[model samples]
Target chain A: MNVFADAIAWIFSPDRASGALPLSEAIWTHLAFTVVSVAVAALIAIPAGWLIGHTGRGRELAVALSGAARAVPSFGLVLLLVLVLGVTHKVGASTTAFVLLAIPPILAGAYSGVEAVDRRVIDGARGVGMTEAQILRTVEAPLGLPLLIGGLRSATLQVVATVTLAGYVGNWGLGFYIVQGIQIRDFSQILGAALLIVVLALVLDALFALLQRVALPRGVSAGRAPENEPVRRRRRGPTAPAPS
Target chain B: MTWVTSNLDLIGRLSVEHLRQSALPIVLGLLVAVPTGWLAFRFRPTRGLVLGAVGLLYTIPSLALFALLPPLLGISFLSEANLIIALTIYAVAIMTRFVSDALASVEPSVRQAAVAVGYGPWRRFWQVDLPLAGPVVLAGLRVTAVSTISLATVGILIGIDNLGYLFTNGYQRQIVAEILAGVVAVVVIALVVDGLLVLLGRLLMPWTRGRRAA
Candidate 1:
């Protein structure tokens, strides 16, 4: 009860502003895992999506595969991976977990980004005799940037939260604190871990928002609501789920 | 077969109890979320805070969250309280988005007409807005339902036994049939619930088909 009460008091304590957390290490490790895994997924998924979308084939197959991937349940897959890969403190386990986590969002973003690219714009660029490479680099990247950023944002958040769960498998994460806190029934440690995670999520989300604006076309690139509008921090992924 | 034969009545009773317990938390969640959502919509500042609180609840792993709560509450402690609360937190987060959107989505023209007819704020809300928002709220409810079904599997860690009991039991004990049964039941339930939601969504919001198609 002290654990729970202390946690509440700690959280609701008037000195919350001055209270420190394990936020820094958690943030750094989480961001590294999230950013790297997502970047890698993008590197793979974007090209694949561009190819599939540009050709208007294989998109369904890729999406269906991702849908199947979603059903595998992250924890279950991680357990299986531990057996196959042999766990270590190295990034292998967490990276693999994040990779699986990262794939769906990247694929969704890339496909939509490509499909969402206006045909007329592509045609106009092509008419100027831009090669496929030039057209992709110039036209598609700018157009698909928002959706791509949206995908990355969601993938990052999902990875962070799931990574917490991953800690129990001996992977050692901020979730280490959470799982440990739970065992001893320590609320401060648990709450501390939880608080650390949320702050990290929001910060990473903000960074992505900044990156999105810089990465997107002038019209689409606005941070949350730039200059005046309220910034709605919506992290989007969510593929079409099963027909049901 | 032996397990079932030996524990036939126990199995039956447990299933019934589990269903009842599960349904209560889910219903409680939706009810709480609706009012929170309405207030959040009314007071914009509260929206983020409420959703943030709910989201924080969600990020806490199911077992850990449950453990934290039950200790504090005591026989105000049912074994299922934590699961209920965690599930409710999730349901609220998703449902809040649905409801707030639904309320805001009430057509301004309709609101204007309601005002002209001297329907006060409460009347406009109850009669005009709620009716319009029904489908979205249902959709949110369905999402909550499906999500809850999945989260219930985590209940195994606490020995709070639901369908997950079957899988965890079988897997740990090396009983293949039990694991298969559990896995099948969960997957089928999720599918059925999801399909039902889609059907309900369509039935409730016939107009959504056009929107989806477009």
Candidate 2:
């Protein structure tokens, strides 16, 4: 009957959700909510952010919008969306709400990532008769991939954590535990729900860390070239140090 | 002309009410979080974990985060204290990041210089470190301020009155003007508050102007 013991048991139990299965619809629904939102946010953010970053004027507005997006509370944004579009709208509306939550990091990442790509590298790719797409595909994306992954890492963690609040609008997730916990004054349930959220965040972050490593393109490591090794020897003529 | 004619007064009233809702929590939240951050720096492992916990705190949905408080604290259905508590937690999340980053940024050379001058750690922290770190801390404060202003809208989702009430209420009643007015008010407040924080940062630390500009 000890609370911690009860919580640990429930957390680890193989068949906690169903008659025979451990995971429940609530858990799956939460996963869907997070997945759909992150997907939507990324789809919108990447190209738009990259395009803006490529243009000198584009960076300011994109960054400003992201700044505003981050400033607004996720719950408030949700409430606004729910009002304009009812909860029953499901995928269309609910996903939009979560997308708002997911976007800031994506934009921040894409914009900064594109800008941070080495110009010399892009130029070299172009000189090799590579098309713009080829240059981006072969050069820029490889270097920017880590930052992009970093953004997804932040965005995914945020979506999972905030997804629980969706339960109040008839979408069940870990918020069920918190709601149920409060109704019974079961600290165990509250702790379980809270722990699930923390686990979800860490688990999601770890998976992305793995993906970032795997997803990163070849011949470009995130680290700067190793110590005491020359990255570029002088071109045998007076040349200015390359501008960042 | 038709729309503005009908809704002008209402927009003005809502703006004042929302500012009141927003300012109270931000001022109070900063008061609580800044001190907690200061206390946090004195300890090591615990401070790191506590701040990490705050980062996690950033992940919680603001509405649920607020609602859960009232139940646990045994407060009434919609307590101001509960609102403040939620705001405080959000504030702490930001303030901790600010304080820790700012403090960490203090160069070791400066600390060494202070010690060399017979200034003890406490004296040095109070005199040199805190002042030097003040601008960064204030930069974080500016971010927290902008975020808190927008978040105060979550106040309406619970039971407190704020601009969100306009949006929520208007939407429930199908009044487009109220909803638009509310959104505009929250945005304006955010913009103005951000400007003020920048101004305050510059005025408080003239050194911050160049740092920010550069």
Q: What is candidate 2's local distance difference test score?
A: 0.65
Which segments of candidate 2 are over 4 A away from where they belong?
A1-23, A52-57, A73-90, A114-135, A157-244, B1-17, B28-47, B70-77, B210-214
lDDT of 1 by residue, B1-214 (tens): 5755665565456455545655766677678877887876667678777766654554444444554565456622225766676666666666776676666656667878989999999888888877777765775676566656655665654457676666546544655555444544554565566677778778866776666511
Number of the predicted model whose lDDT against the real structure is largest: 2
Give stretches of model 1 more than 4 Å off. Answer: A1-40, A51-73, A80-97, A114-133, A177-203, A213-216, A221-244, B1-26, B39-78, B104-107, B113-119, B164-184, B202-214
Q: All models, DockQ values?
A: 0.16, 0.16
lDDT string, candidate 1, A134-203, tens digits: 8888787667777777767767766775666566565255666666665676657676566556666667
Clashing pairs in 2: none
True contacts kept of 2: 0.16
Give the root-mean-square deviation of each candidate in angstroms: 6.7, 7.7
Q: Count the backbone clashes (under 3 Å) in each candidate.
A: 1, 0
**lDDT of each prediction vs. the true structure?**
0.61, 0.65
lDDT of 2 by residue, A164-242 (tens): 6555445367766665555566665665566666566667766886887786567765422332122122111110000
Question: Could you tell me how far off, in angstroms, the CA of residue A102 lies in candidate 2 after the best superposition?
Answer: 2.4
